[model samples]
Target: MSFKGEQHPGVQAPTPDSQGFRLNHTMLRIKDPEKALAFYTRVFGMQVMRRLDFDEMGFSLYFLAKLDENEQVPEEQGERTVWTFRQRGLLELTHNWGTETQADFAYHDGNAEPQGFGHICFSVPDLEAAEAWFDANEVEFVKRSDQGKMKDVVFVKDVDGYWIEVVQADRLSALGD
Candidate 1:
């Protein structure tokens, strides 16, 4: 099907490719790695699949994933690196050295005047329960599930002010063909 603004005669719909490709991960620059890591792990129940520190480059890459209940992360660096790449829906947090020390340091969360990148999303089993948990934990909310036009949808801000969309997984399944 053609999308809006793609009515040009020369433009053709994209055909599915047979390549064995998949979305690896999405990276977000974080001012404070410690705080960001805690927020993601404690609030979202994500674990650190792998951590690569580039001391020479003055930065670090942290790969996090929400693993299955029985899944265990590899202890070896090599094994962890390989395993991290194989997982889907991973979140990469990049931390530049010394940024955490600066009192006035902050990253562009892409929600200001010149907005570019929007937000990342998470599907939970229960929207109301998740919303209550967030509220109890004192997490900042940009928009609640019952707010505005979008019912049963939530938008929360991370420590770095990045927006995260939360929705009910059951609701998603209901909308699927």
Candidate 2:
């Protein structure tokens, strides 16, 4: 399928076994789960749907999502876990046992020398309101809506210094230009 104006010639329809495949989640290794979770939940209005602790592995996974209108998270652990796995656009934060106490611990945010993973984006209903919200919350701005050539899109950094792009998606058609 063609994406935006770029099409990979080698890309084609999924094979039978992959017919129903979907992007389930993207994982980001975090040094401190508490700060990361607070940033995502309080600033972006996301909620923790489920969490899995792998004590043997010395790491834990936290699944969070900004629910759609009228969407409800399952109250039971078994059902919540199943629902979480089935949903799309999940942000999974992986916390290793003791990274939080390490003074110099950091993760590659993928925007430096060997840029790989770029960023995650959030679509807001009102661009102006979102900007004000970010300002009120003292969120670090990588690029503010009015700062650059793009007029209505904004970018902010999380506690981990990961880029989170914010935009009024209704105006996204112009971005394709």
Top candidate (lDDT): 2
lDDT of 1 at 25: 99
> How well does candidate 1 match the true structure in TM-score terms?
0.87
Note the Cα lDDT for every prediction shown: 0.90, 0.91
- Which residue pairs clash in candidate 2? none
Q: Against the true structure, whose TM-score is highest?
A: 2
Off by over 4 Å in 2: 1-8
lDDT of 1 by residue, 1-177 (tens): 444454667976545683567789999999999999999999999988888999899999999998889987778899889988987899999999999999999988888979988999999999999999999989999999889777788999999999999999667655533
Model 2 lDDT on a 0 to 1 scale: 0.91
For candidate 2, the per-residue lDDT at 49 reads 92
Candidate 2, position 55, lDDT = 94
